[model samples]
Target: MNLYAHYVKRIQDFLIALVVSIVLSPVLFTVSVLVKIKLGSPVIFKQKRPGLNNKVFTLYKFRTMTNKKDKNGVLLPDEDRMTSFGEWLRSTSLDELPELFNILNGSLSIVGPRPQLVKDIVFMSKEQRRRHIVRPGLTGLAQVNGRNNINWDEKFEYDLEYIGNITFINDWKIMLKTVLKVFCKEGINTEGLATSEDLGDYLLRLGRITEEEYTAGLEKSKVLINR
Candidate 1:
């Protein structure tokens, strides 16, 4: 890795994330209150994601869905539980504000590959997994390019492209693009879906992986998460 990727980038990420978080503190507070009222308790949503070197880290975001469930106590589908308020939070990217702390704590950078689910990583090939060589980001090249709108293969291609050519100039370019992307409300979800398809599911749908492989990957991911 270059000096910037190896050393300078972390310092840059920390300083920028710190300043941005402080400047946005009021906005953060207001959002938190609104979320609590709208989404109920636990306004912050936490989930396990794979970070650098496939290490597990807890990713935080503002909760954008209710805990509504079926009569059998099964959680409803994301779309069914989603409300207009939550949709607005997602479209405005306000739901992502809490991730600033992830950056502050060194689990993320301001720019790099976005951290994906533990189950998602289990389905990635060795080359695709190279994106994890660096800390995952708050916003990334893939995020700015097309986010959940693009197919999984395209996302991985963009991620690998970013990794192969990390530079200070490139990071800034991506960050600036990310701001615009958020404002434009671009690529928040795949067409006709409340959430992007999981990698294993996508691969199985395309016949790239068998059902056995998909189930095994999910089981492996569970083990990794427990570890």
Candidate 2:
């Protein structure tokens, strides 16, 4: 790995994330309060995501959905639970502010492949999994390029491309593009979906993976999570 990718990037990510967190403290506080008011307690959403080398790490974000459940005690679909306030938070990318801490703590970078769900990791082919060779990021080449608007195949393509060409210039370029993308409220969701489809679901829907494979992959992901 280059000096920037292997060593310098972590230092830079920590310093920049620290400064950004301090500067955004007020915004973070305000969002926290609003989330509590609108969505109740547990204002922060925590989920296990695959980080560098597929290591499991808790990814944090401002909670954007309610915990309302059905009579069967199942949580409602994301779209069903989404409120206007939550939609606004997602569109403005305010919900992502807490991830700065992940960068600060060395679980992420300012720019790299975005960390994906633990379950998604199970569905990825070996070549697709190459994206995890480096620490994941708050914003990534895939995120800046098309985010949830793009297909899974295209997203992995961008991820691999970014991994193949890691440079300081590239990171800065992606970061600037990310700011613009957020401001423009672009690619926050896939068409006809509350959020991007899971990799396993997308693959199964498209017939890229068989039902047996899908079920097995999901089981494997559960084991990873349990570990």
What lDDT score is found at residue 31 in candidate 1? 97
Model 2 per-residue lDDT tens digits across residues 168-215: 999999999999999999999998999889999999999999999999
Q: All models: lDDT?
A: 0.93, 0.93
Every model's TM-score: 0.98, 0.98
Q: List the residue pairs that clash in candidate 2.
A: none
Model 2 quality (TM-score): 0.98
State in Å the error of residue 196, model 2.
0.8
Q: With candidate 2 superimposed using the best TM-score fit, by how many Å does residue 32's alpha carbon deviate from the native?
A: 0.4
